[model samples]
Target: MRSRGTYYLVYPLVIFLLLVLLFPFFVMISTSLKPVKEVYANPPHWIPQTIHLTNFSDIWGKYPLGSYFKNSFIVAVGTTIINMLLCIPAAYAIARLRFVGKNFMMYLFLIVQMFSPLIVVISLFKVISRLGLLDNLLALILTNGVFTLAFAIWLLSGYFRGIPKEIEEAALIDGCSRFQTITRILLPIAMPGVVTTVIYTFISAWNEFMFALTFITSMEKRPLTLGLYNFIGRWAVQWQYLMAAAFLALIPVVILFMLIERELVQGLAGGAVKG
Candidate 1:
């Protein structure tokens, strides 16, 4: 009886929380479909009087949306690749090797996450300028990779630790090299964690605004976050167009989450337990 009563109480609270979470998305969709006049109506409304589908089509021509998406994709993919390349090796070492400062190194990575990017942006700006990487997509890729590396290493190492050592030893006894064992054996088992790290790194790189704003100067090189500025005028903001572009920007991330939802959940749960 208590369990039944608890379910009744919990259902409403869960529904309310879900509604709260989805309300912004609902607003974004509603505003995206609204005509300009409807957007500025005296009392804002939940639904549009007339659906304006042109906002979706118009955003393409009005702004360099394609270029922005391309730039974002390049930066995001580059960051994820670099992150994985560096993280996999480091994580393997931390998980498998009995090394000095192993625990300290793990904690250090967590410490790195505690600091905000704002603290280091100025120093990074000087370094980027000195390297002549300013206004370059490579600059964003590198910075994003560096910032996200700590968490990736920490998570991947935890996932690696969770796996049985006997498996790797058996492969080693069978004459498989360390590298081969990592590539052919351990990686497949740890794929959920890898996918989680990839998705996290990709999203971080995609949504990054501060570093992009600080580093990128060329209009053509700007990512989606910066491209959104085109909708903001001196006096008036293009609410409909902005919302449309924002909604479109969300599609890739939403699709990625949908496809990898199972792996991501397992990765997170596994990492938490193992870490």
Candidate 2:
């Protein structure tokens, strides 16, 4: 029932998405179900004849998946909370306050965020080692917070600026403390940006490879991403086990994106429009 031109434009993208995006998920699941022998078959089995459910058990027994998962949880959750706490107040201040060198400060933050992790890996490793914190959870948690803080501040600051000054002004007249004003008035209104920050921090920490690889030498302190890579390289690549773990690795991020779909969409859309 659609016009020809409209269908022509939409169909390509639809098919492209299906082939490029959906195909990998299909492959991941299919590979996960294959037996090790079938996985190595000369002609890859499109539909795996043998369903190898024990891949999960084999991986669990072989790797320290539980420890890796716990380390990731600690880093992701800790950094998210730190990002929210540090970003909200800092964003409120930057967006709402009139101060000397405001633009200069913003520029400083932008520079920090733009700086790549690779360039500073040696410096960061030295700091971690000097702090006597190498191979510890604190190092990971703090590293995540430091790395992601600028982005959180930058994003939430924009959202705070979008909020009208009148709301906080009224709260101030009513004798509300700065803390209370931030907590009660600004936070609810800037919920989308907060959601965005949380999503970014969680995803960044959960998937971070290079920092963990450099900072965490201990097996128990390693995050899932590094663990997964190590798991793959330990022997002949167990495609079935690797795929199963990859799917598991993806679950939290997928759930997070689904849950905050609306907020994330709005936040991203609003930022695009502003830009």
Candidate 3:
């Protein structure tokens, strides 16, 4: 009876919080469908009087949105690939190998996350400039990979540590080398955590605005986040088109979550306990 009463109390609160969180999404959808005149209507409304699907079509015709998406995709994918390549081996070493300063190295990685990119952007810019990588997609890929590496290693190492060492031992007993054991045995079992890390790295690279803005100068190389500026004018903002573009930008991320939500949830739960 007490549990039932608590459930009733909590359910309403949870519903209210969900509604609050989803309200902005509702507004974005409503605004995207509103006509130009309706967008600036005297009193803003939750529903569009007339849905304008052309806003979606118009953005592609008017802006270089396709290029923006391509650039964003390249950078995001590149960042995720490089991050995983570096993190997997580093995480394995930290989790399984006994070495001097192992704990200290793990703590150092944690400390690196404490510093924001803003503090290092100028220094990074100078380094990129020196390497002639400014205004290049490779620059974004490298910088994004570097910034996300610490967290990825830290999270993955903790997840690796949580797995049973006996499983690895059995693989080794079958004449599988250490690298083979990691690839064939551990990676498959730790897939949820790997998926979670990949998703986080992809999203971070996709949504990154600061590094893109600083490193990229070519209009053709702009990412989706930077391309949103095209909607803002000197006098008035294009709300309908902006919302439409914003909505379109969200589709890939939404699809990613939909496909891997189960793994993401499990990874989060596991990380919370193990990490």
- Weakest 10 consecutive residues, lDDT, candidate 2? 266-275
Taking all chains together, the TM-score of candidate 1 against the true structure is 0.89
Model 1 per-residue lDDT tens digits across residues 99-161 = 899999987987896678999999999999999999999999999999999988877887898
How close to the true structure is residue 216 of candidate 1, measured as C-alpha lDDT? 94
Clashing pairs in 1: none
Name the best candidate (by lDDT). 1
TM-score of each: 0.89, 0.89, 0.88
lDDT of each: 0.90, 0.85, 0.88
lDDT of 2 at 183: 86
Tens digit per residue, CA lDDT, model 2, 78-156: 9888888888888888999999998998889877987788998888889999999998878878888888888778878
List the lowest-lDDT window of 10 residues for candidate 1. Answer: 266-275
Per candidate, the number of residue pairs that clash is: 0, 0, 0
Candidate 3 per-residue lDDT over residues 194-254, each given as its tens digit: 8878987898899999999899998899999988875574367888888999999998888
Off by over 4 Å in 1: 1-12, 255-275
RMSD versus native structure for model 2: 2.6
